[model samples]
Target: MNQNHLTTLLAVLDEGSFEGAADALRITPSAVSQRIKALESDMGRVLIRRTSPVAATDAGEILAQAARRMALLQAETDVALERSISRVPLSVAINADSLATWFQSVFSDVAKWKHATLQLRIEDEAHSLTLLRRGDCLGAVTTEATPVSGCDVRELGTMRYRPVATPALKDAFTSDEGIDWADMPVLRYGPNDAIQESDWRGRLPERPRERRVSQIPSSEAFLEAVRCGLGWAYVADLQSDPLLETGELVLLDSTHVDVPLYWQHWRLQSAMLQDLTQSVVDAAKQHLS
Candidate 1:
């Protein structure tokens, strides 16, 4: 069945009237009627229960769900064809932080809609590799040093972070704690971040009191909190560049943490994965240090 028929059926169920469905679908009522008739004839069943506010017949509900799945699969197929070579599907598991700040430009450069069957899932970097190990994704941008079995690994480089603060907050915090990082309130990306714990403890003059902690799950929001003066944060280089230039935030000191990243993928001879891997590596080489 065509997309038009599937969409028409869904719209009819949503709007609850043939006329209303037609208006929502931007098709003539006759056209909507024709498509529904075609779907009914094709399925050999009465799919919709016609009413003032319509409902799907049992069969209609089944077909509607199937149609929704079909549309999603079709989109995947279309993206694969337009994105990369045939015979390979593109899918990935990644941390939300990387997706929000740095990874989007990789897709923008491909310039085709059907190049690969792109599947994307978001997880934390501390945990994304589990998806690959379970065979869900072909590759990942992760902090794992140990490669998953059947996959090869490459060092992508690091995301450098330093403590940062707004001037006013720094002034108040310094007055209270005397500019020692150990005693300051810090913002963490998540419980598993391990970043500041790795970098700051024992290195600072005073033992860290960690006055208060705030954790924002997404990369974008975590940085935004720092930019808004919520707390001191370990914002990455690429993430901090603009804020530093604009003078919204300042580096706490020369001390920084480098979150060494790696690239890992199934060692399969698929053209689609190969191209994607190469592109991502190229981007990493240019952007990460």
Candidate 2:
């Protein structure tokens, strides 16, 4: 495949539109469209779907993955040969909870590395593997233990989550007959978040008739919502520990969920990627259960 065509394809996908891609590539939109057309003709397949915000077809995803890998290798080579002045971009996916806690240390360590730049895509741990499979990210901190094709996996340890709420909310919602599942407000990270539901599924006798749920997507804000008596939530121990000790938040139940996390990355022979993996493993050791 032509390098310029592949680069143009990536720009369009990354920027989400041909016009946006033209701006990114410093070329006319007509030029961008022509390159894409030429590449499609060469490949004999429709790669990009011409929709609002645009999307890659199955073949497009495959090509995009290859393009990203090629870009990484070229960037590494250029830096090694002193032929490029730009730092290598390392894209990785991480969950919101991990980003707000154990993963912060990874950022701290990476900041000291001068030749690499970190680009993070925050997704739910269970779904982060999608980004890896799509090649939108080169590495991921995910819940899936099974490795994607051409990738390697490592166990990072378990993240324990405790059902917690403010004292006032707990007292109001619980009694001697057992806690009320219905009518009590609950918190979730987002629609994709199953942490709260999974934690309650095994404990409850049956599904509640009515569930009052508030979706707070931001990690820091989600924790704060729990502290402010918005609702009960299954919070990671990393964020709940200090609050539990200080009586700012109360554990609502004894049963806890331990989510095992793993680091999945492309099987590459790059020093920067290896260094990043090592840094992540080291940080996970100190924080996760």
Candidate 3:
């Protein structure tokens, strides 16, 4: 089978439709279909599910991943052969908090090179590894310490969060001894957010049966909501320190939650990957616990 077929399959999966892939690859939709059909015929299996937004079959996923790996290796090979000075794109997944806080510092020096492009896919720290598992990115910043298959995991550092609220909220709770914590409005990033509840559980004797959570998905917006006294939340210590000092936000407890982070990347023998990994580790050590 032609290697180009695998590349076509990847394009189709990335774009989510035949026409979209055609547009991206600068090929006609008919050509795209022909390549896919030929690839599937060569594999002797149905590789794609033929959905409106096309999805890969289990077999297709394997081939797609191989295609991605090959592309990366080929790019590196080209760089070495031609001694290319052009920027090479590297796609990575990272959590919003890291992006908001310390991620940029990791690439500060590299950014000046102007020969390294990063395509960042932001997800929660706890979930970023799913992108690596799906073969969507070459590297990820995640809370999971365990390495994914064919990947290496290195501890970055610990990030700390503390439960905080406005001074007014503290006054309200003090006046009501029978106050149900659940009824009090809580701030959360999304449904998957466990920081608020987890902190609550550790501080209080019992878990709240129900929580009146206000969802603010954006990390910046979530911090702003907390600053504006919309609701109490577990804000990153690094982010909330200034507010806490100024008495804009009050720490409800002295207890701190530490989330250990890790960097996971494909176990490829590539100099560029090694340089990036070292840069991340050095920056993380400077910023995190």
Q: For model 3, what is the C-alpha lDDT against the true structure?
A: 0.83
Candidate with maximal TM-score: 2
**What is the TM-score of each predicted model, taking all chains together?**
0.64, 0.96, 0.90
lDDT digits (tens) for residues 1-289 of candidate 2 = 9999999999999999999999999999999999999999999999999998999999999999999998988888888888658688899999999999998898888899777899999999999998998889999999999999999999999999989999999999888977786667989988888878775577677877677889999999999999999999999999999999999999887978889999999999888889999999999999988
Model 3 TM-score (2 dp): 0.90
Error of 3 at 61 (Å): 1.9
TM-score of 1: 0.64
Instruction: Give Cα distance to truth, residue 194, candidate 3, Å.
Output: 2.3
Off by over 4 Å in 2: 203-210
Residue 288 in model 3: shift from native, Å? 0.7
Q: Write the per-residue lDDT of candidate 1 for residues 1-289, one digit (tens) a residue.
A: 7788887887787578889999998889999899999999988999888787877787887677556445445555655557443323456887766777667767865546344556688877778887676444678888997888678887887778777888777876575536855555678876677776565564565554546777788788888898888888777888888888899888777877777888888776555566778777877887888
Relative to the true structure, how large is the alpha-carbon lDDT of every model? 0.74, 0.92, 0.83
Q: Which ranges in model 3 have alpha carbons more than 4 Å from their true place?
A: 83-87, 176-180, 199-211
